[model samples]
Target: MQLQLQTLPKVLSVLVMEDRIDAASAIQFKERLRDLTQEGDQRVVLDLARVQFLDSSGLGAIVAVKKLLGPDRVLELSGLTPTVERVFRLTRMDTIFTIHLTHEAALSDVTGA
Candidate 1:
């Protein structure tokens, strides 16, 4: 997966550009997220606009990232494609993390805009 990391004033956003996030790519994605979060950002947002498919491994990777972020950190999601959104909703992960309609919205929230 191609993971791009961007930083706002208070949030670090990761845009994943790939059709699928499966077992093969989940580890690398998780590492990227970990590295991004380790940069001392308070908020993290994963942008899944280009991801057309997500499996259990992908979901697990996200959950792992959330855990790594811990209670004090904010981990949000944005730009979820329909299929990936369905998985999140089905798994009730939508309630577990903040889900925004767009990256701009997520950034606005973190940046207090």
Candidate 2:
């Protein structure tokens, strides 16, 4: 559950440094994200380039984070590996979130660049 948070003008980019998000780390993942995002109103971009695997629990945790963010702020995803992208697409979570091809793209979208 190693994650790095970078604060931008109107976005908080969380780079998921772990190679996998599974049942074992789901709870910790959710808690850490909650702690990191609690004080911000900025759009959240979860950079998952390094994440190669995501299980049901991990998916659930991500959805939970989106719900925690509420409707005002958005939870976007970027740099999904093919395997990770398949999970989101299969679960139809892709429609539930804005998926960017890269981390820079997510930031640019928020910054109007």
Candidate 3:
């Protein structure tokens, strides 16, 4: 559950420093995300470029984070691996989330820079 947190002007960027997000780490993932975002009102960008694998539990945890953020604060995902992207696509979760191809793109969209 190693995560790098970067606080930008308009966003809180959380870079997932793990290669896999599976059942074993799903709870930790959710807990860590919750802890990191508990005080922020800004948009959250979850950068998963290092994550090569994601299971259903992992996906569920992500969705839970979105819900936890409520309507005002958004949880955006970026830098998804091909396999992780496919899971989101197949599950149609892609439609529910604002996903960006890269971390820079997500920041650009939020910061309008």
Per TM-score, the best of the predicted structures is: 3
Q: What's the TM for model 3?
A: 0.96
Kindly indicate the candidate among 2 and 3 with the higher TM-score.
Answer: 3
TM-score of each: 0.90, 0.95, 0.96
Clashing pairs in 2: none
lDDT of each: 0.83, 0.91, 0.93
- Candidate 1 lDDT by residue in tens digits, 3-42: 8877777778788878898898889878877876886845
Error of 2 at 46 (Å): 0.5
lDDT of 1: 0.83
| Candidate 2 wrongly placed segments (more than 4 Å) | 111-113
Q: After superposition, how far is residue 14 of candidate 3 from its true place, in Å?
A: 0.5
Q: How close is candidate 1 to the true structure, as a TM-score?
A: 0.90
> What value of lDDT does candidate 2 attain over all alpha carbons?
0.91
